[model samples]
Target: MRSLILVTASCSLLAACGNPAEEADDPIVAETPVAPTNAVDGMAGTYEVVMADGTVVSQTLRADGTYSDVAEGEVVETGSWRADGSRLCYDPEGDEPEQCFAGGQIAADGSFQTRDDQGNVVSTVRRIGDENMTTEPTA
Candidate 1:
């Protein structure tokens, strides 16, 4: 019958427009690169960061291209650091990849700020002390 053929065609069209296997349920997010700012030389020092959840993290950025992160006086992570122009790059141990931050700014009050790949201020650093001195001070 003509009416049965029309309904069948409409059902076929609706099925064709339904969820495709190639389409993902969640949208893919792209990270936007931020413009580099401030040099990494002056940032070589110990910093204490208060995270969004009030978690305090201590980080030491050495001048010899190394860094260490301590939590509650215990070393949690150690890695190497470098400067990709004005951006600060950190390469962690094992299979973990490197992360580079842009728009780095160090304030006179010892506070610092860096932007994520999306140009958002996701990290705040405050200098707590000078670089570690390996040599024993002569009394």
Candidate 2:
């Protein structure tokens, strides 16, 4: 009789084993987003930022991945830009932590939006017109 009770209890425990297929997909699996390559190239040009009061700041960016910001007849920011796989990096002339890569936007209209490493938009630069740059001897 004890063996019978033990067998009956084991059978009851097995019968209460709950349902399968509680989940459909693997919880451990996740998807990651891919970044674009030439987000900055679309912004390569001389942009003039017009403020609310109509103030302007001009910036010239080269295709070689170098940029210069001119304000008050002086260059404030000078840096080289490059792409690391899917990331765009902006490093100063040398080893400096001021490099911006976290959040940057190059609009289709040649406007630019710079952001910090945390992806916060810092500055907005708009394309005014073609630089029409020419080199000649200064008479």
Candidate 3:
């Protein structure tokens, strides 16, 4: 009958529409790799700190959170360091105040710049050796 054919056609159309919930049940999602959020991971190494005045200081950032600066083969400063988000902060072992610098991510060539509060570059730290190289050999 005409009514039976119409009902069959309507059922076919409804079935072809499919269920939204079923379609979303097994979606093919793409996974993206996450980058490191802490800048300290790449910061523990020996670097040459090139100041704005063209003075170069050899600095070492240890994995134990301590740091030391050498100028003309002498240790001029010692400090403790920490990373706050993408910023690197240093607390010197004296009357000196703590200093924090932005732009802590090192580039592919193992160099990164430190920016002051006014977004001016204060120094460029370039990695020259691994952190282990600064450590004394154990017996």
Worst 10 residues of 2 by lDDT: 1-10
Write down the lDDT of every candidate, Cα atoms only.
Answer: 0.49, 0.40, 0.54
Off by over 4 Å in 1: 1-40, 104-108, 133-139
Q: Pick the candidate with the highest TM-score.
A: 3
lDDT of 3 by residue, 1-139 (tens): 1111111112212222233345456554223333444545545666666776767776677767787776777676777777655456677787777766665444545455666667776666655666777632223
Q: What is the lDDT of residue 97 in candidate 1?
A: 72
Query: Model 3 segments beyond 4 Å from truth?
Result: 1-39, 104-108, 135-139
Query: Which residue window of length 10 is worst by lDDT in model 1?
Result: 1-10
List model 2 lDDT by residue over 99-137, tens digit each: 433223344443444443465444454544333441112
The sequence of per-residue lDDT tens digits that candidate 1 reaches over residues 1-139 is 1111111112212222223332334344123323324434444566665544455666666767677666666666667766655456677766677776653433444355555567655555555655663211233
The Cα error of candidate 3 at residue 125, in Å, is: 1.7
- TM-scores, each model vs. reference: 0.60, 0.45, 0.64
Error of 1 at 42 (Å): 3.5
Query: Model 3: which ten-residue window has the lowest total lDDT?
Result: 1-10
**Clashes per model (N, Cα, C within 3 A):** 0, 0, 0
Clashing pairs in 3: none
| TM-score (C-alpha) between model 1 and the true structure | 0.60
TM accuracy, model 3? 0.64
